[model samples]
Target: MTDPTYEFSRAITRRPAASITDGLRAEDIGTPDLGRMLASHAHYVETLKKTGAEVIELAPLESYPDAVFVEDTTLCLPQGAVMMRPGAPSRMGEVAEMEPTIRGVYDEVRQIAGPGHIEGGDILVTGREILVGRSDRTDAAGVTELTEIVSDWGHTVREVFTPPGVLHFKTDCSLLDGETILSTKRLDASGCFEGYRVLHVAEGEEAAANSIRFNQFVLAPAGFPRTTEMLRQNGYDVVEIDNVECAKLDGGMSCLSLRF
Candidate 1:
């Protein structure tokens, strides 16, 4: 059975603004750069189609560029969509805005509530367990809530501590398939995933190693030549997109959009 939490007919993302970083001059966020970003995103849209996934492109709302899409944070279990409360204050509004669209996509949708934050970027699923990262964005309370919420669906939840430096769980880990996983020493593997199988990428691929799986939509940044090849070698075709604009502020394929 397809894991009820994973699906890939359609995905969603917020349109970015001319500049992602604050205080940066318009020249720094020039038209050419923005154009490159858009073209790259368009490539991503096409790549999703290659995996038989459809795109649900959302028009920008007042053009707030910092909103890390809550769409991904809201995971779809067999029960419903659990809308995560984002840890970032500037991004809290995004969850509210995305609920209506999500409801249209799934009949039953739920919320992850405030004071307990969870960001989609920090969660990864294997065939059996939902690995959650307890980080600056997704706090202790947030993981607890997730554990309880998903337990009802018969899915086990496990916690991985985010090294103080990394911002998200996925920044250091990604799933290649049901049993294989690509992660980094930065994650302190033996400490978190005691008995699971893991492949540790070299230092260079740490950031690029974090990719999101949407059906066959394997989302990763434009770089990662070696890591991409490794994935391809493992029988998974890969899609690389330019997230230069989004990357400036720690965004990537997974952060920019939510797939369902």
Candidate 2:
């Protein structure tokens, strides 16, 4: 079999803070149960380990309510890693906390300096191209800076407009493989993924779009059966885990871990 384009050997994640129930959420969803969120996070870390990745679980930052979603702080790539400046002022400190961890693993690491805000969730690395989404958490300036940084690594950066209702680009879509994407119908219609093949999430299962394809299996949230079936029918080995509490905080499978 051919090697997968986005396989990873290491990953980073953070424990959910006791303040996790205060995380930023678009809707008025009830607070997530901290105990349940922690359990789910532990399960996520375990799953990452099962993928043969050396999972680094960072201590939770009670001050940063949204820090559990570590994927928003930096983008880890084979070339190196990029520490981001989150557009949300409350999330800015997460970058500083994530830098040392990233530096430990990458010989060459870069930072998206201020006046330019970007979030890892808005960046997707697929083969030779890096697709960045222009969202509330990521602006054009951020994308421009990111493009310049990754260009040195021989990557072509393309900016895509994230839909209005989405919190981040990856919230509506994810890279399933080098040439295929798992996306919500709304995002697929946004014309951002013109050249790639898209597998639309089942109707009413939009959250399922935010999934990750680890080394050998696809990590998807439980309770989205239709979407799960779609993945199975496409020949992927799927591992479903309960993410009820995380979902309440606008977090998903991909948001919990940063793989490289």
Candidate 3:
């Protein structure tokens, strides 16, 4: 069966703002080098293109320091594009800035109202259902609102509690195919993916769980040799790229683009 999660032909990404150091971070992991970040981002865009995805690169929004994490701004589904309400108040405006671009591509654009903050990172869409994590960044209200919106589109929404210390649900898991999941050992222990085939990220490389299985290739974060080898062994055509700079800001390969 075809995996709905990896059936993306178009993708949207934003350039990292020059003031990225001012962006939000869960931990003070040293400032990222802007020059290296830019180079890495360029390589990321090229990788997406090489995978046959039509990449839409948006200019940097200098005012929004964390604008580079574009995946948090919206969720692009086959039905339409939903403008998300970021959990972080500082990152909220990034949604409005992204609205126009999203509207230009998708005819059915939806928005999540306040009293409910839903970031895309907390959502994972599989072929049969959509999983929304109940995390600090995504609350019950948000999941409720999201459920109401997508249920009409023929999708069942499953709510999962994000484990403590995980920034987003995807921070510990990713959909590799319709029935397979690439996840951290911590999340797998939660039993959220009990029915799916769970492929654990290599020990000490927990960050590798946040990968993107786009079309025919898996865009994995570079430097996680063990995890990369594991994916390859599983028969995936993996393409690893450096995302260390973005990782400093709690980003991963999946965070760089909103694909649909």
Candidate 4:
């Protein structure tokens, strides 16, 4: 049986633009190298295609430096797609750019249409519920609006808290399967994942927590060896993609694509 939460038939990704050097970051680690980012991105898209999924590769939008992080623009659920309103002023235009593509894929598409803000990076859909984290990018009003929107589709949204200093909720956690979650120990200490099976990433390898379970494989950032081995011993087919360029801008495995 296919698990709607992690199993997907298609995915959407955008190529990193030359302007990615200007992408938003909490701190300036270094300017992202567009050539290196493109090579790594090609590998990511190739891995997805290997799973027999139709991967939609969108052209780079030079006007939007952060457009490559497409997952922030919309949440693609089994019932429909909901375009998010990003709290970051610079990111608000991304949703409009993603709307037409989302509409083409889903017969039913909804918009937040809010003064509130939410981003797909702050959400995680499990077998029984949808967990939304309150972060700098996702607010209480955004959670409330999302709850009301999905309730009609029979989904229960649980408002949770993102770890302090985290970019997004999923930055410190990810759904591994229907009942299991891969999370950072710091985030798990808050007890947000209670009632669910949790696996902590190896200390200092917390970035691996943002990995994605796509079809039959787990796509993870390449430099986290310990975390990769841990997932491997647990029966996951792991694929590590070079993430150095993206990391310079605070991006990770889950940030690159929108799967459904």
Please provide TM-scores, in order, for all candidate models, with all chains considered together: 0.86, 0.97, 0.98, 0.99
Clash pairs for candidate 2: none
Per-residue alpha-carbon lDDT of model 4 for 1-260, expressed as tens digits? 89998999999999999999999998898999999999999999999999999999999999999999999999899999999999889989999999999999999999998889999999999999999999999999999999999998999999999988999999999988999999999999999899999999999999889999999999999999999999999999999999999998889999999999
In candidate 3, stretches whose alpha carbon ends up further than 4 angstroms from where it belongs are none
The residue pairs that clash in candidate 1, if any, are none
Q: Sorted on lDDT, highest at the top, how do the candidates line up?
A: 4, 3, 2, 1
Locate the minimum summed-lDDT window of 10 residues in model 1: 23-32
lDDT of 3 by residue, 178-256 (tens): 7899999999998999788999999999999999988888989899999999999999989888888888888888888
Q: On residues 1-260, what C-alpha lDDT tens digit does candidate 1 reach at each position?
A: 66433456777766655544441221344323566767777777777777676777777655445653434457765556788887877677777778888898888786786568898878877777888888878988988988888887788998878887777887787776676677788685547756667766666877776676767656777677887877777677677877666665655666766766
Model 1 alpha-carbon miss at residue 153, Å: 2.0
lDDT for predicted candidate 2 compared with the true structure: 0.88
**Local accuracy by lDDT, each model:** 0.70, 0.88, 0.90, 0.94
What lDDT score is found at residue 147 in candidate 1? 84
Give the lowest summed-lDDT range of ten residues in model 2. Answer: 1-10
